[model samples]
Target chain A: MGPSLLLRAEGLKRQLGDRLLWSQLNLVLAAGDRLGLVAPSGAGKTLLLRALALLDPLQAGTISLQGRPPATWGLPRWRSMVLYLAQRPTAHGGTVEANLRSPWEFQELRGRGGWRYERIKGWLQALGRDPSFLAYDAERLSGGELQLLALLRALQFDPSVLLLDEPTASLDGATTAALEALLIEWLAAGQRACVFTSHDSEQIQRFATRTLELRP
Target chain B: MTPMTSGALTISDGRLALSALLILVNVGLSAALRLGLTRSLLVASLRMVVQLLLVGFVLEWLFRQDHAPLIVLVGAAMAMIAGISAVQRTRRRFAGIYLNSLLSVMASSALVTGLAVTGLIQPQPWYDPQYLIPLLGMVLGNTLNGISLGLDRFMEGLRSGRDQVETALALGATRWEACQEVVRDAIRVAMIPTINSMMVMGLVSLPGMMTGQILQGATPDAAVRYQIVILFMIASATALGVFGVVGLAYGRLTSADHQLRLDRLVG
Candidate 1:
């Protein structure tokens, strides 16, 4: 049998007024699994990602993470373990380091729970960037730079589950390839599981252990 | 430039020239900045010039007649214009709702200032052209600014960061709890400039009313007393007008269910 399921969704449904976005959806993400969610524009991929992150309420049925129902888990605890990277990848405050370390400001990260400075620096280097970028203003960063920063921020949470929406949509080819290599390394480490959505089929085939498509 | 003497323009010679020059300088600076606000600046300048000239002639006529109803009519028209100006400055998602908000602002400001000046200050002839017109204008104008700032910031906060706001809601936050951050920011921004201006009024700068009074040859002590009274009236009017319009507009922007009407905004 596969590793114990880290997340499970059953009979999940959402309706925006009269329009049904998703219905009767079922999914399970096991530990170490790298899952890719594919959908056409407006097929509610972002909504589903948000729902899985417990940022959006599912209209029907249930979702559980690590055998605890979302209703049972404390909000801060749930969010700490399940980091979500939104599509926009925009950060609120000044400086790249400040954005990357935003979770540190959260009450949940108090006392030995802070993101390791060394690990963050290492990751930045791996992404072909350095400590120099950390001092740069977040608003001044290009889209690709912001996207990478957002991914780095998610990783800083030390989450058991990472949900990213089109994380590479703005990246250059070299950065995209580097991101794929990072994903492979992350999966190989077997410490965290990831679920992401992307339009590039080649990247999906290379990185996605299993893929699910959201239909119109 | 036309070789024209300043006195030929109107009865109040130097004061008119100064006000006109100040307005022209503001307009020129706005154009230089390429703020895409030339149309608004031009229209506002034209409105101020024409309105002041017309009001001057009308007040001259009213003073000669010494009739109360005609003076009250002028005040009412000024209040109406002030209300409309407040609404135009406020950026709302549903622009159609601005009319109601504007009316609310006007009513609140007018009721507060009208009662204070006419009933309490009670200048001779109660509707004296000197006291009634300028005092009412200051109160109405300041209140208009507060109304605009409060409404505009509130709507902008709702529009931009909508996803985060909705996320808070989905996290079982009450509607007020979900919107608390935005509300706080908007209200703080709206109140700050007013508070700052009031704090710095006498020391850093003499306000427009006081300056006008000084220029018009009123004693400095008398001008200061009128300024103090007018300032108090304006502060009260601004608070009431801003609060009323914001409270009403906030309710109307959301449905009974408390979802933001995103599509309704032309912005």
Candidate 2:
């Protein structure tokens, strides 16, 4: 691995009870790399993504950020840079604005300071969300809306790499295109990278520079 | 008015024999309704009789002892037994729960008992067995309930809210911050019974200690004032016990890297 790589995992393995989810896996996300993770249903695509994001423990492997093992970089520090966005994320019960503003209250993020409303409103606008969307009660939002808010929260944190699990699965075609555009804008902003798991190969062809497929 | 003392009234051998009617009523009802509890009723009654006889003899010896250290030993033994029972009542098993519960129960019981002997009850010679035993028993009993309720809620909450906890961790929150809500919930669950009892203390019914004190020929005013102190003491002890156990569990249930060691939780 060269210095260009932002995140890497080697010989990764995960298990559920006595059943093996996957074994002897390797993954790499470099600067500006768009990696598409494709696998059939029940193939543990989310599990692998979570493992790469450091949300799930590695059964037998090593995950490194900037060539440092997670142990040395520290989880909070590592995860702050290498983020994972779940398929269906849960939020603290509040308005959309409150949900977006919540993570900043965390001590780790506290040193990074708070979210900027103008910047978030700009990002939300790129996703075709109006300013009023921020004021909407988060509990009442639809699945797609929730995903958008989740994505927006992740994007605002400026993570260098993102493990997106079925991020656009619930969005309509127009919103999906807007999400792609928003992601592109995010990538273009800095030394950023993304991994997306989607059934839509067409979206992968357009968005990801390469793809990894998991077999049952 | 000065408090009057009455001679201790003893239940005679005939009266003690007549107390068997309580068991008879249960057995008779089980047979009449086909409730199938007759065997359990008989066993429980027999166990209670034998256990009480042994405890009575032991209490007699404890009361006779002029030694102060005997008080500590007895209190510790009671706390250990209460701790075991508290952990046993939790349907879920937690790693290192025995130590956690035992420490919490001992700490709360000791602290509350110390306060009682030093200030509130102020039994002369402090280690006076009569006051120490009953006070320790009451503190241990309430602390036991609080700890069991806390352990049950904390484990169940962590299991059910794993995702939420994980999400918070991923967002760079520490383990304590991530599980803050669940910890708060555990405290609430543990404190509920004590709170409810306080609420209904005098209005709905007479409480146990008050009833016993009144039956022992204490004036109603004295009984009521003692009950007030007792209610406050109970609530304080329960909070301390619940916090000690639940707070210790948070450390045990997570790793240094802020990951939840949910696997540590057994059946």
Best by lDDT: 2
Kindly list the per-residue Cα lDDT of model 2 for residues B68-91, writing each as its tens digit.
887789889999999999999998
Inter-residue clash pairs, candidate 2: none
Q: For residues A80-134, could you state the per-residue lDDT of candidate 2 as single tens digits? A: 7888888888777889999898888887788675888899888888888899999
Supply candidate 1's per-residue lDDT for B84.
75
- Report model 2's TM-score to 2 decimal places: 0.89
TM-score of chain A of each: 0.93, 0.94
- Interface RMSD computed for candidate 2 is what? 1.4
lDDT of 1: 0.73
Give interface RMSD, per candidate: 6.3, 1.4
Is model 2 an incorrect, acceptable, medium or high docking prediction? Answer: medium
True contacts kept of each: 0.02, 0.53
Worst 10 residues of 2 chain B by lDDT: B1-10
